[model samples]
Target: MNTSLPPVEAAPTGPDAPPPGAAPTAPAKVPMAELFITFLIIGATSFGGGVVAYLRNALVLQKGWLDEERFLSALEISQALPGLNATNMAIIVGDRLRGVVGSVVAFLGITLPGATLVMVLGVLYASNAKNPYVNAALIGVGAAAVGMLTAVTFQIGRKQFGKWIDVAIILVTVTLINYLHVSLIWVLLTVGPVAVFIYRPSQLEPPSVPPKQETVP
Candidate 1:
């Protein structure tokens, strides 16, 4: 007689889990008008490059349109590609929610508010270009923007900072950019690949759903 270990069933995966060959499930269909309104709010309110913060709060916290993991995944994809992060995010999120039309609505909704405001502000600034008060106001706005950016960065990267590797990467990137005056191109080319390789699919473990508790016999 031979003894063998019992066959082990794999743990259930979350939304991304479908069988290896099966297509991943589609995103829930959202009403076009509602989607447009959501992004419009983000576009109008988010200022001084604080769009990402507004986006996180709107998409994840307020709307529940995307969970934390999915939002971060989308953010990662957006940042990796070209163009502005704000617009890139709009395209990805919109496409995920409603395909091509969703993408268009999101892009327009997020951009239109800022574009219109910029047109008006540009005209105003052109007239008041040398006004001392205007310059002071602009300086204040810049400082606020910096604070917002820093806050959002901490919020998003808080968990990742638990990893020493992540902390090291961040410090290195900052030192290179802020202290060494290395170009962004050099930083991305060098740090980007290392980060990717470290977090590559082969090395990382998938999130596992807890097994159901069994009842007493």
Candidate 2:
């Protein structure tokens, strides 16, 4: 007589399944406390106007929280809107990782140190405004800030500057704003459309060729 036990079925797997004998993967949720602490450290330690660079180092290089492309995308969105890029980035990234509470914590963490320092510095500057040393130091700082800004601008725009079309746009925008004294709203309304038209899909497509004429019978 046949007395063999029935065979058991193995578990099924899909794209997200781990390889056999591999450890199970965990979800990508970041702890709220860790998020706040990380941003707080970035805010406290970042010097000059290089908070963005510091943020990249911490989030991308050190923590592996955001990759380069995601960071730049976040930065573009932040700059396109009307707020500080660093704080905007904090809010965006935080919200992405953990929603509303994350946004609040990240914003507070990144801004609190700077805000507190600014208040202290403002009080000190008010009392010392009359001192010649303070005046000279402030002037030096302003000049250095201008130089740093120029350098950073060129560095960030180096790839775009390599293209003649981009350079032309830059020159035209500068001339319109600086020399022509055109309102930014008008300049954007005028130049924006023209730029879009210049690079439109139809403009880039080659002229279609007609089929050759039929041969004589």
- Candidate number with greatest lDDT: 1
lDDT of 2 by residue, 1-217 (tens): 5654222111133345444334223324556777888999998998766888988998877766777888899989998787888899999989877799889999999998989999999999999999999999999999999999898889878997998998999899999999999999999899999998998988686658786788997
Model 1 lDDT tens row, 95-137: 9887898899999999999899889999999999999999999
| Winning model by TM-score | 2
User: In angstroms, how far off is 185's CA in candidate 1?
Assistant: 1.6
lDDT (Cα, 0-100) at 26 in candidate 1: 41
Q: In order, what lDDT does every prediction score?
A: 0.84, 0.83
Q: RMSD for all candidates, in order, please.
A: 15.1, 12.4
**Model 1 segments more than 4 A misplaced:** 1-35, 46-76, 79-85, 96-101, 201-206, 211-217
Q: What TM-score do all the candidates reach, one by one?
A: 0.65, 0.72
TM-score of 2: 0.72
